[model samples]
Target: MKKLIFLLLAFLAACTSTETKKATSGSAVIINETVVASAMERIKTSQPGVDQTLLEKGIRHAASLWREEDGNPSDFIEFVKANYISDPVRRKEIFTKISNYMESVNGHFNDITLDLKKNLDEAAGEIDQIDQMYGNYSVGSHLSDDFFSNKIAFAIALNFPYYPLAEKEKLGPGWSREEWAMARLGDLFVSRVPANLNQALNTALGNCDMYIAEYNICMGKLRNEEGKQLFPDDMVLLSHWNLRDELKANYANKENGIEKQEMIATVMERIINQDIPEVVINDPDYEWYPFSNKVMQNGKAIEAAREPDTRYDLIVKTFRAMKDIDPYNPEMNTAMMRKFSWEMEISQEE
Candidate 1:
């Protein structure tokens, strides 16, 4: 039975992975060998003391991102020649300028996003479905597109080439603050997700968050199989975090702690399995017996539809959206790797 369940879970995972691959795969501009060689030669002659290997890697990385939309090969060559700064002093000055500007940009974008979604984010008011939908809409989804279009992203890529996490962990201790900042700057352009994909991801995550936030279980409406009231009439618990925490708190209830814990676990299982009735969710209009998986309205038995696989479907959508952006990133190719190893700084096995 456990093997069967594992296989079922694996099958679902595979389905989402396939969907993500389909969404992300595409043809992109290839910077050929000739272009790389020419650029390398140009940089070496023009900028003598600059590290040759770093120059090669930086130019290649920048070239990989360049599209026909940006310009033809000759135009790309000219831009590289014009923009490549050899003098260490001048390069540091440019980094300082970029760092200052980026701080301002980051601050303003954060303020804008917070302002746009303040109502939905706050715990104060009764947010309807419409508000949830609007909150899902991202105001800063197109920032990457704008940056790439304006050649600012290309400039950053050309100057501060990214180093992998492993490299950083090994070398970071010896690095100065400014050097560390430059490494972080390099990290920004390592991946490119199109504006549409960004919007889709933001929407999926927003929906999931809103659903979880509003999934309040009216503790008053819950009953055991024998029709015994388990919780106080006015007490409510949000699923699944608050509910889980409440269950944890029940550990000190030495008399009925195990029974209460079992009951909450059953409710959580019902929710995760998507077998919980729709009417019981966030609705105090119905009484529910989770163990029996039954519902009642107005002291009479009533039928209700099972909640749709909304949580699972949202996971799939998020995966697909992330997968769409996979091609643009070479180093951190998959979303899972990027999230685990890079963002969370947690190893996969752990």
Candidate 2:
């Protein structure tokens, strides 16, 4: 279930706002304060009795996302004038329409992804390179770009401006259901990452998932001191989740539980340090003594190669992929910041 969730997240991460041709960071303020004030005043003059604070916030937010292709300051003012909604009834109707459209788009894309990932996620026979490619491919990757190109994203941003996490935490209790939904919708187009970068991140995470899925420890082959197997024959567990779960379960076993726990710990340490025998990993042909890090095959001890830091290599690959996205995200420049502040809606200190 965790693996499936990870896979799903990897696919969804590819659906961020599409990159602009300029390649500037989203954090850079494109519209100046003068233009923002002018746009806000123009909207106020056009629509009498409009909420001044919300109008300014919405105009500024929309202007921040405007690019060279999106037109100049005069065009931006015109866009705000045209798209800004002052009437409550009309605003609600538009919000509902946008919500329904987004739901349909997201649902169909998710269905397509699930179908593509079936072979990789399920025990549906041998997985080919094509399966991996399809599983890693994100159908919604270009949705952001298309929306921005058509000015749909800008329209949404203009009316439904985003609130900071701190601001939300403070005022969320007083917000209505529609307000909450609008806030979430505002979050959809905060930054524009390139489609290629999103695809690279998806591939990196998918490769990590594949590596972990195939990493199984043959517990029946793990021999302790005095040449005894603690686990039953044919007992196999995936590392490190299953291995950790089995170790926790052994705590109830008063007899030989400590020995089993120690053996599992040793196995974990070997895995972390990249000294685990290559032949013992997902291979039942060799007998492994975790305590001494020894490998024996058919009653004869043999020199076995270590895992060559493949674990760390994959981790680095995923890290680099995330790092490549940092410059595009002005608010959350680092991956950790995005995970905690943007995704988790909390600070690491909290």
Candidate 3:
């Protein structure tokens, strides 16, 4: 039976892996090599003494992001011709303007997000279902689509092409402040993840956050094997960070320190195994004995059901949400790859 179960699990794993690869493999490359080549040649011919390397990289990167909705080959060619800055002074001026504009746009978006998340993140007041919905709504979710529609993204991509982490590490030392800023600016608009997917991802993560925020263990209601309360009546701790911290702090309590740590360890184990009583979480009305896995209420023992794998369910939902975004990001298709290569500027192999 165990062998058969193992084989079944392996089959499922293979199926999931195959699905992920299939999803990511279909990232549409609409702009063919011929279009890219023609666009580069036309721009170079039109503007004499232009930087050959920049011209090639910028045009190719812009072409990689262009879609049918953006326009035809001729339209792309015209855009490159019109937007590619050849003169050093003119390029700097344009860079400054774009930088300022992006700063303002990003700043306002951040302000809006903070305001939206105020009730969720803080202990200001009671959070309703509407508050959760508002918190999950991402104001900047459609920003990428809007930028693409306005041709601002294309303009930025044409002027400032993205550099991979390895390339940036190699060329970073000699670059001036302005050049560094331009390279950073080029990092935007590399992917075209849809707004709906972005919102879904946000909601999934927000739900997880809310679950964690509400996961408080009433320490005051905990009892040891002898039915003795070790903690104060008002003590409460949130798992798993606060619980771990409390365990660490208890090491200094020479008296019953090991006992407290053992109880805390038992609580953590129960949480991980999903054997924690659902009623005991965030409820001070019940007394829980971690060592015996028993619960009592109103001075009498009572029956309670264990948590029904809600923690693991939330985790799987978040993972699938992140995976849904993989197709839009052709270069860093996986969330792990994006975290290491794009966000952290470090390759996964390292």
TM-score of every candidate: 0.89, 0.90, 0.91
TM-score winner:
3
Model 1, 125-159: lDDT tens digits are: 88887787778878778877899889998898888
Stronger candidate by TM-score (1 vs 2): 2
- For all candidates in order, the CA lDDT equals 0.81, 0.85, 0.87
Q: How good is model 2 by TM-score?
A: 0.90
Candidate 3 per-residue lDDT, tens place, 254-285, comes to: 98999999999999999987899999999999
Task: Show where candidate 2 strays beyond 4 Å.
Answer: 1-28
> Which segments of model 3 are wrong by more than 4 Å?
1-26
C-alpha lDDT (0 to 100) for residue 198 of candidate 3? 88
Put down candidate 2 lDDT per residue, 182-301, tens digits, no spaces: 889889887767677888888999898888878999999999978899998889999999999999999999999999999999999999888999989999999999989889999999
lDDT of 3 at 347: 62
For residue 339, give model 1's deviation from the true position in Å. Answer: 0.8
TM-score order of candidates, best first? 3, 2, 1
